[model samples]
Target: MSDEGRRTHGFRRRTPLGAARERLLEQVTPHGRTERVRLRDADERILATDAVAERPVPHYRRAAMDGYAVRAEDTFGASDRSPAQLRVGETVGPETATRVHTGSELPEGADAVVMVEETETRGESLTVFDAVAGGENVAPVGEDVEAGEALYEAGHRLRPSDLGLLKSVGNEAVEVYERPRASVVPTGEELVETDPEPGEVIETNGQTVAQYVERWGGEATYRDIVTDDEAALRAAVERDLDHDVVVTTGGSSVGERDLVPEVVDDLGEVLVHGVALKPGHPVALGVVEGTPVLMLPGYPVACIVNAVQFLRPTLREVGHLPHTDPPTIEAELTRKVVSDPGTRTFARVQVDRDGETVTATPTRASGSGVLSSVALADGWVVVPDRREGLDAGDVVAVEDWEWSG
Candidate 1:
């Protein structure tokens, strides 16, 4: 029932995923520094303050189409059989019509626009062929948005259309939260840069974790690979304590070479040593020099799962990202997958959408060390700790890999 037992037995008594997440979130405080950025450069940045419109969009009443501006009554009783002729004038009046093009300013006293196709111009007079109601085919002032309205509220993540909308409302710049800085350190004696011998493994989890950190709205600093030496690994993590958060992949298990947990404990405090999640049970949550430190498993899939389950949420919390669930779709399982009842499992599956019915098939390579399993998967389906497994034809919500978080 202790943390030590949980680590050795695949989370038989491991902390629940939700409890672990809550503990980490409780310790995270958003990087609340506000900095003004150009509207064009504000995409994907979380807003630190509300953006109020200085002026109404469009700012003027204009014609929505090419037509002749006139009073609604002036076009009354006009049809293909019975046409009404009105004198062309410089200004709009009951007895006068003024020629206007699309987006042109409407003349004074003009309340409607009759399409140019509906009128025939002869000399200084226009013969109307149809009748238009008041305010018809004309755009009123503030039709899109009114002045002094809030375009975006604090904590809102700016999207591409948000940029255009802010520009439409005359916002040239905006205040956004400063992105949190994350330091990623990869440790293992067998880790190599590029060329790997028979016993050596290519070090890529650092890059993977860094990319995930960046995608979750934090700035990532990928440190060089560290060997299994305790002093070297400890020094590398200690040097990065100045960053907002520290993440280390490998050296997290209970093996003799595993030193991250010890380093974190010696430097500060270890909050959590293991979790009840398959392929991610070896994750370590701790603090080093007042900064949050997360230790992930060395296996590629385990690294990915731990990063998503813990690191992503931590980054989002500290970076002030919007609290929104990752995009998901409901799909029926193509086949049954057995899972340990003691641990929650996140199995990668490929989803096939055929009309309304969606089917999810498990990836061929499901091992924790297989990196291709994640690459080939479209999303993941979670089996809760209380549930034995999912049955074939059972509906499950699949978290999209690209849109989740």
Candidate 2:
């Protein structure tokens, strides 16, 4: 049989997740070009170059409070019993006697600030009983950041605070990697888009996969729901190969109606299928016309899980962005969790943290069709096949939802 013909046959065995991830990384390449984008448009985009500060953050020494700017020496030894009085103009710079509010620039000859509450103000003259040290309540220039300093390093994702800092340094625009474009195709005759009239199932896997693609910094521009005909599937894959990555849901398993792998094999090469993981074990990885195509299962939860586990990482790496695993924290299992002896399992869990103690609430249904369970879940716990089950109070790593609050 030809190399392609071998892959068309049912998967021989399950591949480990670590090996699968390494292979996907090796097969995918980074995007070729970068673009300069406005700072406002750069949020969540990965930086291509280091951003240097053109000037100090504050740029000048300013008052920290609304009070009197005074020379500490002028008020030295002053007290409520033996108060020292001086004409405000003579003690400081001419016209410096004008009151200044917080964040206002300090006037010349002013070395310290005496809060308004500390001094009893009269018509033209003021009496100060308290003495303040010089330079107190002053924010010096370059205190927050130095000029010519690296504000944000390359590969940094632009967050709200990063954007604010960039704008503070007078950067209206920044250079960042362009987001990758993707196409999604859902294949199967029995599959329906949504709310099928009768004798049909709704097509939700495509939408689930598309959402995952977008959340991982890829643009899902094209989405098609097509029948299981090989010609139709081949044409869809060929048209979508123009994109950086093409994602197809359904038809990856060994079922009689499954045709995605066959079509992909005819078009290009299938790198892997039947990963050694539960729920999404039938996932397929392939390339068509030099563009990567990720074939996920038809079940909603399965599609989303596989996209996050495999496809999202590939897209993030290709865009020159860091690939981060879901945030994890050690949490106590609320109850015992049983699993198959040889296959790795991921259980949706609800987590509640109190101070340093965390509790995991395992979901009732972990099936691939239970999309609602994922929504209600705060995170997921990995159950290694070798372990019998997790006991209560045992600490386990919990992979949090991407947007967990």
Worst 10 residues of 1 by lDDT: 1-10
What is candidate 1's lDDT per residue for 250-272, written digit by digit as tens? 98987767878887888888788
Q: What is the TM-score of each predicted model, taking all chains together? A: 0.87, 0.81
Whole-model lDDT, model 1: 0.88
Candidate of highest lDDT: 1
Supply the TM-score for candidate 1: 0.87
Pairs that collide in candidate 2 are none
- In order, candidate lDDTs are 0.88, 0.80
Candidate topping TM-score = 1
Error of 2 at 308 (Å): 2.1
